[model samples]
Target: MFESIKYLQKGNQKRAYQAISELDIMKHLAAYNPILCGTLPIGIDIACSDLDIIMEVDEFERFEEQVRELYGNQQNFKVKKLHIRENPVIKANFWFSGFEFELFGQALPVKEQNAYLHMVIEDAVMKRHPSIKKEVIELKEKGWKTEPAFCKVLQLEEGDPYKELINYGKNTGFI
Candidate 1:
């Protein structure tokens, strides 16, 4: 499976069967998230358990509920509790143990950073498309390194890069 993913990354169609098979699994899983957009983010190497989606929301009350529904509590898939990083908000992580997939995260408030991550999340969920892929690809193409990637791709003046990047990916459109 990993080899097939690598081949697809190289734009090879012969081995695309592997990537497509994985994508099929993902597409089935999509029925659960109902909020995620397009075949997760590709072109990057990730173990099945590597964090696949880290996003921000306006409220955390329903986060755990949503996570459990999307990932289930089986040994192969489970969501970690929420934690804080660099500020006074909660973030969540999930581990898709079966397929070596791990994509989970949440963002909250930050210092002097006023990003509308909550809105982005809502928009993406409502729209039902992974709208941020092109933007991420765009940022990478623009030589946007580190934190500047979000600012450049989202066309935002300033805000939390982590939240912005994740939110953009969750949304249906870049800007």
Candidate 2:
């Protein structure tokens, strides 16, 4: 369901659609199976929300090289390798078409990535409890990141908010 940016063309996501299309993000990263994730897709975004694209990548070197070659000249372009939850990941960030884009890659499938899973879970929660959208957005506006905002709104105060939310999704059959 997250395969294309067509859904972004409607409602408040039009700007994201224009930005992604203008930059040809999906086409450029097609080899990696990029999937857009995060608050924007689920509609809890604040003004600072970014276009977060996650991908499955087997070769960090090749991914980094391609990202650099493709977006190297973009304003504030930066790429680096880092570990998240013990998994090595390559991340590239830059400004394009009036939006900030964050491209993340790891060896795992895009659907299994934390960002994608979190977004899926958040979307499920928002759908079940429609009113929480405003609360999540309010928390985000107050400097809380997406996962933590959901945790706070749901009163999931124990453990890592990230993992907790995932567990919540699992228990609630949202994952």
Give the alpha-carbon lDDT of every model.
0.40, 0.92
Model 2: per-residue Cα lDDT at residue 148: 91
Worst 10 residues of 2 by lDDT: 39-48
Candidate 1's residue-wise lDDT over 39-86, tens digit each? 222332222213233334445556656555655653455555554454
Clash count in backbone of candidate 1 = 13
Q: 119 in model 2: Cα distance from truth in Å?
A: 0.5
| Whole-model lDDT, model 2 | 0.92
TM-scores of the candidates in the order shown:
0.33, 0.98
171: Cα error in model 2, Å = 0.4
